[model samples]
Target: MRINVLQHTPNEGPGSILDWAEVHNHEVYTYHPYQFGHLPTADETDMLVILGGPMSPNDDIDWIKAERKLIKELLDNNTPIFGACYGAQQISKTLGYPVTKAPAKEVGWAPVHLQSHVIPGIPETLQALHWHEEMFEVPDGAELLFSSDAVKNQGFVLGHHVVGLQFHFEPKPNNVREMVVNDFNYIPGSILKQTKEDILATKVPEENRAVMFRILDYLSQ
Candidate 1:
């Protein structure tokens, strides 16, 4: 399968998802809208993976608007999509869901409690990498899949094809480390409060990855 990844920034790339794709012999292509232009058509894509970024979905960026349009097109055609963090917020907004600031930002590793059987193949609890200030409301007609202490709408499913997650199931150890070291500029709040050491310590346990892989495999199906 040809999986197209929509990357929002240089630091935010497909991590473990890329590994999964390579191991499964799937072709992976990426479009960095911050550096490149807007997203391309999904003509050749069998799956769409939207990675996270520091920006909000409501940002008045031209590229973000274009990507939202592309997401709408993909949804209209029933193309499989998986969105993370900011990407998930975009997906929610494009589908008429409201994206708003959370009571507090959720950073580092967190636990998401599965709210429903939306992702039928996955288990009930999973630890995932989270770094975001905003949260989205579950779209109308979409089933809520997961929730965290900081965010209620952590994950949702639209039909059988589209999945939006507010956490990072795709980050490998190195990916998380690089994000902390290089992308620390994007981190808000007290810089001294959240150190690179703290971020590096964040991890998704192996059991969580097992459930994540199940969701990924289910979406691929």
Candidate 2:
């Protein structure tokens, strides 16, 4: 399958997802709106994976607006999509759900409790990477699958193919380090922010890699 990925920043590129795609022998193409500022039509993609970024879905940027249009087209055609953090917020906005800023920023490793059985292989609770301060309601016709203490709507699913996750399941150790180096200012004043040493010590990535593959396989089906 050809999985077209929409990336907003260089530091936030697909991590474990890239590994999974390679191992599964799926063709993966990435579009960087922050750089290339271009996007593909829904017909060019068999599946879509939107990566996280510093920008909010409500931003007034032209590329963001264009990406929304693309997302809507993909959804209308029932193309499977996996959205992470900012990517998820984009999905919510396209689905007519309100995306708002959270009261506090959720940084570092946090626990998300699965709230529904909409997807199998999702544990009742799992520690995942959290880097965004934005939150959104579960879109209409989507099942709320997970919730965190810091954010109520941790994840949601629209049908069996469309999945939106507030926390990232794709960050590897090096990826987290890059994020911390590039975006540390975003966490300078947050009480929930973890130190670089602490973030590097996390074991969450290894635990979540399998879960990420499970979801990917599910979407590929």
Candidate 3:
């Protein structure tokens, strides 16, 4: 399977998703919109993974608009898509749901309360990495899988192959560090957000890694 990942920024690349792709022996191709990388058509991609970024889905950018069009095509064709953060917002916008400012900016490790069953054997609550101020709304036909105290629509599941997570499950410890280092100012000094040291110290546990792998496998199916 050819899993195509859309990367909006250098720091926010496909972290553990690369591990999943390698484990399954699936071909993985990453496209950098900032660099104008060639984007393959929906039929050429087995799965599309949209990674997180600092930008908003409502940005007046050409590449961002183009990506949304591709996402719409993928949705119409029932292609498997997994979006995180900004990527998730993009999906929601293309699905006719508007992206709005979250109640509070959820940064670092926070617990997401699972509201529905998207993956089997999943915990009722899990500590997931988050770094977005804007949140996506639950689409008309999508199921609200889980949410956090800071944000209600943290995740949604559309049909059998489409999923969007407002939090960061794909980022490994190093990836989290990179994100923090690159955009340290984004994490405001608030009770809801975490400090750089605290965020870095709390490593991405093996449990979280396993859960991410399971979720990816579920979407790939």
Candidate 4:
């Protein structure tokens, strides 16, 4: 399968997903809109994976707006899409949902309770990486997939092919460290009170990768 990953920033790339793609022998391509200023042609790719970024979906940047349009096109065609954090917000906005600031930003690692209806194959609770200040309102007709104490609309599925997640299922230790250092500016005031040790202590459990893989496998099937 040919998977096109849209990267919104320099540090945030397709972490564990890239490893999974290589292991599964799927072709991978990356587009950094910040640096390259171009969106991929949706018809050219088999699947779309949008990575997280510090920017909000409401930003007036040209590339951000263009990417939203591309997401809409992909959805209209029933193409599969997997989006995380800011990517998820874009998907929500493109689908006529509202993306707004969360009352409190969910940073560090947090536990997400899986919706019983979304993925009964998975366990009830899973620790996932979160680094976003904005949250999406579930679009009409979308199925709620997961929720955290800090954010209710953590994950949602639109139709059969579209999945959006507010947490990072593909986090690595180094990736977490890099994100902490590089994107600290976007950390909410509440999270800023946390010490570096406290932040580093939080992480997605190893077992959660299996759940992520399961979701990918299900989507691909």
lDDT of 4 by residue, 1-221 (tens): 99999998777778788877888999999999988898789789788999998788898999999998889888888888999999899999998878998867777777899884665477888888778878988888888999998778899987778889998987677777877788776565654356556777775577777777777776777
Put down candidate 2 lDDT per residue, 1-221, tens digits, no spaces. Answer: 89999988889989999999999899999999878888988889999999999898888999999999999999999999999999999999998888998767888888889888766777888888888888977998898988888778989988988999998989887888898888877765554668766776776557688888988888888
Error of 1 at 57 (Å): 1.5
Give TM per candidate: 0.91, 0.96, 0.96, 0.93
Residue 144 error, candidate 1, Å: 1.0
Better of 1 and 3 by lDDT: 3
**Which 10 residues in a row give candidate 1 its minimum summed lDDT?**
186-195
Query: Which residue segments of model 1 deviate by more than 4 Å?
Result: 185-194
Over 4 Å off, model 3: 189-191
Q: Which digits, one per residue and each the tens of the lDDT, describe model 1 over residues 72-133?
A: 88898888889999888999999887889876677776678988876666767777777887
Worst 10 residues of 2 by lDDT: 188-197
lDDT of 2 at 38: 88
The total number of steric clashes, by the backbone 3 Å criterion, in model 3 comes to: 0
What is candidate 3's lDDT per residue for 21-109, written digit by digit as tens?
A: 99999999899986885677898988999998888988898888899889999999889999999988999999888999888878888
Error of 1 at 204 (Å): 3.7
**Ranking, TM-score, top scorer first:** 3, 2, 4, 1
Please report, as a residue range, the 10-residue window in candidate 4 with the lowest summed lDDT: 187-196
